[model samples]
Target: MIFSRERPFLLVGAGKMGGAMLSGWMAQGIDAAAIVVQDPAPSPEMAALLSRHGIRHVTEVPQGLTAGVVLLAIKPQLMDVVLPGLKPAVGDETLVLSVAAGTPVARFEAAFGPVPIVRAMPNTPAMVGRGITALFPTTRVSAAQRDTVDRLLSAIGTVEWLDSEAQIDLVTAVSGSGPAYVFLLAECLAEAGRKAGLPADLAARLAEATVSGAGELMHRSSEPPATLRRNVTSPNGTTAAALTVLMAEDGLQPLMDAAVAAAARRARELAG
Candidate 1:
């Protein structure tokens, strides 16, 4: 739903992810003049975009500008300082959506006085408008408000609604931190190729293209990832030879499992 002037969209933090989302929204016909961006240091790209789109980018939360949906995309550690300024504009009917990692709904409620809140975890991919956000809305959020939040978040990428807030930590470990895992895989592949006598640039390009191409194929295919793997692996083939080590008991699976568990634990800890 396009926001009306009666309830403008107030974006807190116009950094990469937030800037990407705003770009998407503008592409989809949202009025930039009706939106306000609060960011201390917007990138050059973001500053140019705000100027082009006629959106307001202010360092302080503007007085008397009511927000229909106040989307918080700031750092979790800075919430105490950042959120207090936002309190005055939060009306009874206003909805709050947070994309700050490891922040819980209770913290928002305590700060904002029982406003409807939706906590979300979005990855860095949102900067490219290909991210997936996992959301958990509190009971105070109505169906209509949820739909609005969905439409707003859809600007970045797909949105997955969760049944419980506890699952957000797992989501944080998985999708929230998943990009780094994929990036590391590509880095390792490139290094291995270089060690195997490929030129540095060639090895890096090959690894990057292979990983990205495989990811694109997986996205377009209806078959499961496991099935895709099997299709690529022939009995006694080079792919199968590589898979043998990868599928071993003490291989990538166990390592990834431990990594995810540790991430989830840290996510929960950060919530405190």
Candidate 2:
């Protein structure tokens, strides 16, 4: 309801995340005609989707038009060049929703001159519509525009709104980069199993299944992760033994704390 079919939804990129969002919008019954995508070289799959939806796809920005929502889904490095071309299409009423990581709201205002902006950090899982995004909106954003952003992002996954833009960098580290960390955990788990004498293929499968199942349980359960861990551990049992090493003084906790901090530091650096 927040999104308007009357006004054009100008999308600057049709890459993975952008394409995923479009897929969601279509599935939710958005009129394909209302969307216009601009990408120099879209993937075959993306091209097919656009064709199927009958959405306009252009390699260049059309001259002198007002877009209701200018969604920027391109790389942050390209913003310097891309924003200039897009500026003409951004009217005072345009709500700019950027999904580019490490890009701040001021960057857009500096280019487009104080249009309503919402900066978001979304992870790779958005391809599967299971991603979690963190959003930071400028003070200029109206309540109705915020609702529009909420509905638009809901297409990808759950959304968390932050009170301050500075918090977005932390979010960039957490949910935005968190999926790779989980994948790395699965890799290490598989390696550990292989080292413990299981066959390589079997070890990988076991590790993958365990991680995925545990993640599902965490999602389904109302209890905290710590409680879930304790629930699985018995006196001097295998799970407890593993937890003893994992929960040691110099263990997973300290390591993970350092990892998250390092990621946050890098996020701030990228923003700069």
Candidate 3:
């Protein structure tokens, strides 16, 4: 069964990421009344949103209400505080889906006591419904439970499953922290254009447009990135000149390798 149709689900934290997921669910025609949002202090945006949609809003967990699914959207640091209180509300049948970065499946299982747990890493782009999420489900999770999590996550963006728990950290480093890397590329490109004598405003505009357009192209085209690069690179043209520098011995390969590695290391540290 698609989880979107499941009624009376509980969102344990209505922060930015949680709110975004709520918005996506509502956009996809999920009944707002089926959701119960709990936050100590809901943002003005979240409050107004829930009110407008007629969804139940609570400053704390409601008594005598059992949710079909419990979304643990709270920060990782607050898990101990939140999970203990949440145990009562989470029935044995309830599937727990967590979007908290660095929180492991074992931790959730320990707290919730052998419940079906799914740990997901979703990037900031999820706010715009263009994100990619990596999901890792505990061994106890049923195929139906996994599908339910996938359906809910897919409402916001694309979803992929990882076989190994260790891959979750790599996924966090890649797609989770990947947006910042792309933004940094835009920053570098704009600054390089300004240094090469373009006006600041024009340089920024060009850099933004170029990056956005290239991304759109990749999304629409069937060709691989290497093929796309070769398509625009003439035998002795400006594109080729730039490629020579970027693909050289001291260029992108080593830089990106180090950057991803650092992010993966940081993810491991966060897990601890």
Candidate 4:
């Protein structure tokens, strides 16, 4: 068991990300009885899940209880208001795990003192058990606590530890917002195919399948992506022609660089 049953886990929100993590934890065999959810207005789907599992759901943080782990899954905007009330749940031994982006460790320290806090950003693919999450642990975090946090997070997907919190903004721009970029590519590819005379529906299906298949192939391959691209590109072939345009001086790389920079800047703004 990743968590100790002595003190219950207090989940501060039950939105999509929080609910996804909750579902992942339950599916991994964490005791449902050891979990308590605090969300004023959870979706019907999430409410149904809490009911089915018999996990405690509360609109407010209950008094007179010390949580073993307090997972902060609320929005960054709500941190200032909501955190002040969670003091009762955080004991000295508790590990605070946050999945809220743009909210740093200092903000948490302001709320609950110098307790062990880990701030993380997880991509949406975590719901399907294929996500990648980047975490930044404060100096206060113990080695054993880090291991526990790793185990809990690994329930949903890959967990990577960061050396500095500033890198979080860069990560937010890349993998944190990366899935949307891939989806956009698929959309553009389908439109291009339709414009080139393929049936609209067929083009959409082909684009979706190709994107997903390529992603899976990349996932399974040991070689770097460049090697895979080389293997796919035959001399003077259709793919090679397309790559020529995409790899040009003013091509995909520059566009992606600008997009990521913009996202990172926004992340920093949100943090402040």
**TM-scores for all candidates?**
0.97, 0.96, 0.94, 0.96
| Cα lDDT of model 2 by residue, 137-214, tens digit | 888889998998888778878999999999988888778889989999999999999999999999999999999999
Task: List candidate 4 stretches off by more than 4 Å.
Answer: 1-5
Ranking by TM-score: 1, 4, 2, 3
Least well predicted 10-residue stretch by lDDT in candidate 4: 1-10
When summed lDDT is taken over every stretch of 10 residues in candidate 3, the lowest stretch is 1-10
Candidate 1 collision pairs = none
Clashes of 3: 0
Query: The CA-based lDDT of model 3 is what?
Result: 0.85
lDDT measured at residue 212 in model 3 versus the true structure, 0 to 100: 81
* TM-score of predicted structure 2: 0.96
- In the range 186-270, model 4's lDDT, one tens digit per residue, is 9999999999999999999999999999999999999899999999999999999999999999999999999999999999998
Expressed as tens digits, the lDDT of each residue in 154-184 for candidate 3 is 9888999989889988988889889899999
Quantify all predictions' global Cα lDDT against the true fold. Answer: 0.89, 0.87, 0.85, 0.90
